[model samples]
Target chain A: MTIKNRSRITVFILSFLVWLALTHIGDIQEVIAGLIVAFIVSMIAGKFLITTEKSEHIVKRFFSAIIYLFKFLWEMVKANFHVAYIVLNPNLPIKPGIVKIKTDLTKDSAITVLTNSITLTPGTLTVDVNPETKEIYIHWIDVLSTDVEENTKLIGGRFEKLLTEVFE
Target chain B: MIRVIGMAFILIGITFDFFGVLGLVRLPDVYNRLQAATKCVTFGSAGILFGVFILQGFNNFGFKALIGIAFIFLTSPVSAHAIARASHRSGIPLTKETVVDQYQEDNELKDN
Candidate 1:
C-alpha cells in the first residue's frame, strides 16, 4: 500500500479504538455504528491526522509514548508544587525572563510536543518559535542560568530526549 | 478504601485550584500569571478527573474521566502558548524585574 493508504488505515483503526473507548462496547449495534463512523472520519480527515511518514519501529514508538506519558505526568505534578511554592512565598522570588534554546528535532510534530511539554513543566512557558533556526524562546519564571546549554538542559533536555526516541 | 483515596485526590485537586487562583491574583505580569494559573489549574482538573477514575474503576464513567484527563493534558498548554505569544507580540512588556528579553532582541534583529 502507498503511504497515504497506510495512513488512512492507521487513522481508521485509531478512530475505531477511540469509539470503543467512548462506548465501552455497549452492544452489537454500537459496534456497527462505531465502525461506520470511524470509516467516514478516516476517509475525510485521515491525511491531516498524521503528518509524518510511517516509522519503522512502531512497537518501539508505542512503548516510548507510554513511558513519555507517565514521565510527563510526574513532571506535571512536580511542576504544580514548584509553582505553589512560588505563589506561597512572601518574597515571590521569581526572576522572570525570556531565554532562547535550540532543538535538533526536525519534524513539526516532534517540535510541537517538545514545546507543549516545556510550557507545562516547572517555571517555563514557551513564547515563540523561530522556524528557520529551530530555536525556541521561553518565558522562564525563575532564571536559573544564563548559559544557553545549561538552560537548555534545565528546561527541554529531558523531554527532547524521549521525544527523539518516539518521533525520530 | 478506593473511594476514600478518591476523595483525597479530589481534595488535593481543589487545593491546587485554589493555589492557581491565588497565583493569578498575586503574580506580577500576564506571562507570570499565565504560568501559575495554567499549570496548576490543568493539573488540578486532571487530579479531580483521576479521582473520579478511581471512584468509578473501569466502568464507562471512569473511562470517560480518563479520556477527559488526557484531553486536558493535551490542550491546555497549547492555549497557554497561544496567549503568551499574542501578548508578547502585541507589545506587552515584561515586568521591571524580568532578567532578560531575548524575544524582543530577536525581533529587533529581524527588523534590522
Candidate 2:
C-alpha cells in the first residue's frame, strides 16, 4: 500500500479505538457513529499526522520506544529526587547557567523529544534550539562542566542514543 | 492489596508535589523556578495518575488515567520550553548567581 493510504488507515484505526475507549462502547449505535467520525477525521488529518518517512523497522522501533519510556521514567524519578534535595537544602548550592550542546539527530521530531527529555531530566532545562547548527541551549541548575562534549554526554547522551535508535 | 499499593503511589505523588511547590517559592529566578516546578510537578502528577490507574484497573477510568499521564508527559515540557524561551528572548535576566550566558552570547554573535 502507498504510505499515504497506510497512514490514513492507521489514523482511522487509532481514532476509532480512542472513541471506543472514551464512550466505553455503550451500544452498537455508538460504534457505528465512531466509525463514521473516525473516517472523516482521518480523511482530514492523515497527511499531517505523520511526518517521518515510512520505516521498514516499525516493530523494532515500537519495542525500543517502549523501552525508552521505561528508561525515561526511571531517569525522571531519580532526577526529581535530586532536585527535591537541592530545593530543601538551606544553602541552595546551585550554579545556574545556559550551556550549548551539539546533537546529531536530524529528524525534527527526534530533536524535539531529546530537548523535552533534557528539560524534564535532572537539573537541565532546554532554553533554545539552533536548528541550523543542531545545537541545543540548556539552562543547567548546576554548572558542573563547561566543555561542550562533556555536557552533551552528561545531559543528552542516553536520550539521544535511544532516540536515534527509535527515529533513525 | 492493589488498593494499598495505589495509596502508596498517591502518597509519594503528594510528597513530590509539596517539594515542587517549595521549589517554586525558593528558587532564585524565572528559569530556575520553571525547572524545579515543571520537572517535579509533571512527574508528581504522573505518579498520581498512575495510582488512579492502579486503583481503577483495566476499565474505562483506568485507561483514561493512563491517557492523562501520557498527555501530561507530552505537553508539560513543551509548555516549560516555551516559557523559558519567551522569558529569555524578552530580556529577563538570569539570577545574579548564573555562571554563564551562552544563549545571550549566541544571539549577540548572530546579530553582529
TM-score of each: 0.90, 0.92
Q: List model 1 lDDT by residue over B1-112, tens digit each.
A: 9989999999999999999999999999999999998899999998899999999999999999999988898899999999999999999989989999888988999899
Query: Chain B TM-score of all predictions, in order?
Result: 0.96, 0.97
**Local accuracy of candidate 2 as per-residue lDDT tens digits, B1-112:** 9999998998888899889999999999999999988899998998899999999999989999888888898999999999999999999999999999888998999899
> Can you give the lDDT of residue A167 in candidate 2?
92
lDDT string, candidate 2, A113-167, tens digits:
9998898899999998999999999999998888899988999897888899999
Off by over 4 Å in 1: A23-40
Off by over 4 Å in 2: A27-45
Clash count for candidate 2 is: 0
Candidate 1 docking band: medium
Indicate the DockQ of the complex predicted as candidate 1. 0.76
Please report the candidate that would top DockQ against the real structure: 2
